[model samples]
Target chain A: MKDALLREIGKVVIPFIQIFGIYIILNGHLSPGGGFSGGTILGVSLIMHKLIEEPYKSRIKISERAVMQFTCVSLILYGLLKGYSFITGGGEFELLDIPLGIPGRILSGGMLLPLNVAVGIIVCFTIYTFYTLFDKGEI
Target chain B: MAAAANFPLLIILILFLSSFMMPVLKRVKAVKWLSLSSILLCVVLSVLTLAYVQQNGAFLYKVGHFEAPWGNELKIGYLEAIMSIMFTSIAALITWASFFSADYEIKEKNIMLYYTLCGMLLASLLGILYSNDIFNCFVFIELSSIAACGIVVVKDKKENIKAGVKYLILSSLGSGLVLMGIAFLYSITGNLNIGFIHQELVKVKDLYHNTLIISLGLFTVGLGVKSAMFPVHIWLPDAHTYAPSSSSALLSSLVLKAYILLYIKIIYRVFGIEIVKTLPILEIVLVMGAVGMIFGSILALLQKDLKRMIAYSSVAQIGYIFFGIGLGNILGLMAAIFHIISHALTKSALFLIAGNIIERIHSKEISRLKGIGIEMPITLGVFVVCALSMVGIPLFAGFNSKWNFALAIIDSNRILFIAVLVASSLLNALYYLPIIINAYFGEENTKDRVYMSKEKSLGALLPILILAFAIIYLGISSNGIIDLIAKSVSNL
Candidate 1:
């Protein structure tokens, strides 16, 4: 039955999926995974929630209103950093981090870890943003 | 501060995290104000980067201070600076306008997600702009494509979703080809920095002729797809047609141009002018550009849908940039860069105005645009000014750039090219000028201004006006912009 498919795709199973997403995000700088991969995983988990749960309840999980505001803020943060860099003369498009850690280690590279984390957030919220719109039958 | 030297990447990370937080903040009544403050702070920061670009010519920074021969590097230069300014300046303005529109278009539900994607889009764009190495560029490219896909598909309507799928597949193929080319270049040159690779290429040019040629061909193909060159333009019309207006502005204006900028870097900087001048490669690119100019414009003229027509027009305009590069003269190259700025101004301005019209009329078909101009005069006026610019009428951004392009072509003394330019400009008029005439002189519906939002839409309108005015301003004071472009292109 479709219900069984939904049951298997529930939060219990989805949490593990979300965790996997987290790992990919955190370890993005080291291996092939990065913000995009991790973020996509989070998006997939949200989809899992959609399959198993009632649409309305899951609506609150990733509110469309929130993604709008978040996407705006995320961009502004990039602007703010560059603006600050410009003011202080670090040069625009400058890279960051110690890369003190081993090449393959987590937290080892400069801003790659941070970059991955940012991408992960974007991926998850964007995916959820899509789901919210779709399930609302607004799409 | 050096303490925050990692600021470039941090910006994206913070934005990514904020996407997660944005949905939560929507619960708070004050969230709108909060978002405003944050974005303004960021915009101010983005504006600050121009000073840095002016001060530092260009350099690559290794993430974590890891030397680039071993680890990846973030390339910061004049080109990157220009791209950042373009991306952030327009992005901030649009997002600001979106803030006001969010009050209307977005329901109580979807506003935060919209903001999140906006940030993702910015970060991905910045990532693309800042990445020094080709592989790193690929990552950002994918990030941009994915985020863009999200924004376009956010509507989730069948048309929008279908557009997103097309965008994704075409973008992926483009990226795949670019990656393969990067691999090939790395194998021969053993380096990726444009200048450094130039050195390596010379040392090994004799031994690796086939590989070099193949890789160059691949890079051309890859970047061509992204640039939406004549043969590789299948995805652009749909992607541009289907996305929301702000999203369309970003896609048509910034995203496609960014890829083209990469092509400039790949051809001029990576391979060096010596090769471009000596080899027949410039001819290949030039020929493609000439065809794009004539072909894209002709296609644009036939479209009934305003957005689809505009999309096709972009395909044509991109050719102008390539034409400048193809001419391979200082004036020609300068003209190309100048045209890039002009087209960005004209195109994004038009798209924004189109957004206003779409909001009011609830349609993008050219036929439905009848008499709608009466109610939305300002929006229509902006569209007219921009269309004139596209047609390269005198005293607009398009005119100055076209003049430079003409001079460049004449200097090259290729009579066929002159014909191509003349023919294409006429073709450009064919598509764009008619739209303006139709809007102004067409049949009128009842003049009703119900639900018109121009006063509140000033945030969006101001940029269009500034750009349109600049078109005229740049046309009159063409020397300044031309000098800047000359300096920049010559440096490249």
Candidate 2:
């Protein structure tokens, strides 16, 4: 809110927060932290950035429509991906099998990586939108 | 033919996936068309599924790759197939009707959200109907509750929001109790699948008597509240009255029926009827249901608001369903299922008619509806048919259900409760007949009204007329449906 100290600290902190969020999303199948928690962390960083930079004219712009479209697209992709898996698995068809990679790798979990990424995008946008809507009543 | 087996799962997926597309689409008309067309597709799929079931018998479909004990499953039977058809078709009709009237009731921007909620709600309701696992049912129950509450508050009025909060809080409590019940069942049986749990429960029948009773009570009261059973139906009137008319129709006709269906599955599949009959729970249910029949109608008689009155009638009709279940006989349960069909048709038509009248007259007060028939002749004529059905007039759907209920009572050697049925019908008449009389006959009421002046277009009235025709058709040929229900009950 026009505070120089907080803005300086935020600039230093936000990048690390975002990188850690991405790491968790990438390693979701191999670790405890996954899409939801990682996405929440990223969302908090966004909220902090918005709070500190909202008073400045040069802040990064994120339109409400873009956030909504991103959320909806991610949700649709998530549904389609999961629905494909369910149909193929339930019907016992071996169609489009992405070979499972080494167990500890980021790509090891067939569809889990893509699903996690989609969920992460959705949760991130959703949380940021919630913040904006509550903060200003129009998101 | 093999692919037809997957229609149940496809119906759920189509609804959920298509609903997410609503907000992303720019055109409202496209969103509405998409919503209607998806529901129509489900209707066709459901009818195909039912036909497949009729030919092949009930089958269980595994969700994803997991087997029965480990993963989710959908048990599609005669009951489920029929229910899916009913839910999808009725929802399609309601969405079509609301297409004409939603702009008047809901804000332009919020209309897309309304369709989204309806889609989600129908999907979740179908989920509840098809789920073979107790925990799966619980998840669907929670989803349906939230979607139901969302549709209620989507009207964006202060009263709607207040009613929505009331409904949400009470419904959450209902869900919490259901979760606890599932926990109790899971702990004792070590399985979530209904068939597996039944096997385990039958083996250990005598070991955990008290726990069994507690879990049974929890399920009964929890689902009872969700379905608007007698004592716990307080939130229903406000929520239904304040919601948009299509939402009200869906709530009264479809949503409440799903929970009751789930309850029926629990009683029959999880805990067999022989085991349940030994407990005092069925007797309590029977008494409560009988009381609800009388009190719900009595309450309906006191409501001045037309929607509130119709909402209370739902409570009374639900009592009849529970009463049928409580009879704990084959015929009784069959009657309950049949009543579900009849009530779904009759009540949806009634609510949509109410919407038509409200749209044209800009009023919801029953007093203001006097001589409305003189203006909206066809709408009131449909209403008269629906009211007669509610009053159990011979050759209407309600009469057949009451007849079956009486036979079930006699079959169970509970002939005294037949009086409750008669009294409840009289009470139904007390509330419904006066409006019909004032609408059609009174001189002062009819003097100023122009015939056909307030009638909706033929396209708008077509759904209600079809529903009315279905009601009469059901009444005339209920034997076939009753036989089908009997087979389903035997399958249970």
Candidate 3:
């Protein structure tokens, strides 16, 4: 049970897991996973980081205030867009003049790509922030 | 070519896509921008479709290119467009208002799920509004139930979790019963399309359509439970009270109406008035609606919790909807739809303000909320306006609809229902008026030194302010919205 060169396997495995997390995040709109599913995978990666890289190193990973800021701002921005729709006579989800790209490309599907990316960022950061806050029993 | 009227499908896709994306965007923080954009995009699409539908009148959309006479089809008519207008706009408001009210410990704990449910609820509501196929409507109803349940649970609090579980169980049983009804209807016509079934129902006036009638009865109970109709409305108070603030606003505003709309469609379209004019079951609808109207107000009067009372109040307001539908006049139906918007605006205003009060006072009990009007005068003022709307005070939108609803009842020889409506609105005033009194007029509690956050309530307070003003605006300039609804109803 003495730990030897086997620790190197954990080292190699962490990066592999993170790569897979990124894959899930980027390919979310096209395939099965996206912001939510991928963000969670990456968030789980943070726990692994804390386990192996020492607890103190995790302090710099995210700040609670930033997460709060992100959560509020995202909600506000959503409100503004919806408010605009109510005031206007157009579509509910108002789009820019961007043309709907061909359906097959990664960049296609109108706003879904950007929307997914936004969700991914919110999810990942919020999860990491929650872990940091909760780990210390800090509200 | 009529298959091209499937514009609502794109709206659903947008919501689903955005909801799915919300989880992982922490690094970029761009998801915030994108989510709003998606909603805005939906508004645009709906308006475009509105124009298209108006110019071309009603068109049936056979989904997956299936021809209408045999396979299922989605009906995109004027009635559908007006309903879409109601739901999408209300959804936009709730989504917008969510920005300011919530920022808490479990920031990302279930944020993605929250947005997903919101989107799903919106999509399903729109689907229910537009879909001409009974089975497809059933499918959307199931989606709405699951989404609303998910919204309740998104907070993951013990109370919220329990509430969500109860709703899930009840709603699932309701869905099963609803699906059974759809199956029965399908058996009769050998087709699932509403228009097709409408034609078949007109043809065969002979014997034993009793199964179809029984199926309608089953569908009534199923949808009634979802509507929190009086006797079976056990889960409503707990589920709505425990859900996060935004979700509660949505449940009050749009969720119940979608099912009620189904009841309207079924009675008018599936069975048609040819048989309905003979059956005394229209009396049953009027009776149930009247009971809910009075019972909801009485229950609301006894509740200590702000959200619970609001939930009870919703039960009563739903009674008004069924009342109008049961009145069975174009004017009554128009009034019902108009009341849907008025109630949506007013209830959301009340709830959003309640969220702020909860945030400030950290309690929902009216007794604990002594002299809150002095502390948060602006919010109290907003609530007053919303209350005025709810009670059908002269200048708010509620008066116009209530007046029309009463008129409809009179026109249909159900003049006694008018007494019920008047008594219910008064009873509503009794329950809600006291909260306003306690908040605005009550003497200050001498003991607890609450350090009120002046800045803390801005998020929840502002949007409600806007809606309270909308109640007035719509009341005075209600001609346009009224015209739209009237046109939609007459088309039906």
Q: Candidates' TM-scores?
A: 0.78, 0.98, 0.76
TM-score of 2: 0.98
Model 1 C-alpha lDDT per residue in residues B398-437, reported as the tens digit of each score: 8888888889888988867888888988888887776666
DockQ: the better of candidates 2 and 3: 2
Against the reference, the lDDT scores of all candidates come to 0.72, 0.92, 0.74
Question: Candidate 2's residue-wise lDDT over B31-129, tens digit each?
Answer: 999999999999999999999999999999988988889988899999998889999999999999999989999999899999999999999999999
* Total backbone collisions for each predicted model: 36, 0, 37
Best candidate according to TM-score: 2
Model 3 lDDT per residue over B319-343, tens place: 8887777776778888888888888
Displacement of residue A91 (Cα, Å) in model 1 is 9.4
2 versus 3: better lDDT goes to: 2
The TM-scores that each candidate's chain B achieves against the reference are 0.90, 0.99, 0.93
Which is better, 1 or 2, measured by lDDT? Answer: 2
Model 3 TM: 0.76
DockQ of each: 0.11, 0.74, 0.04
Best of the candidates, DockQ:
2
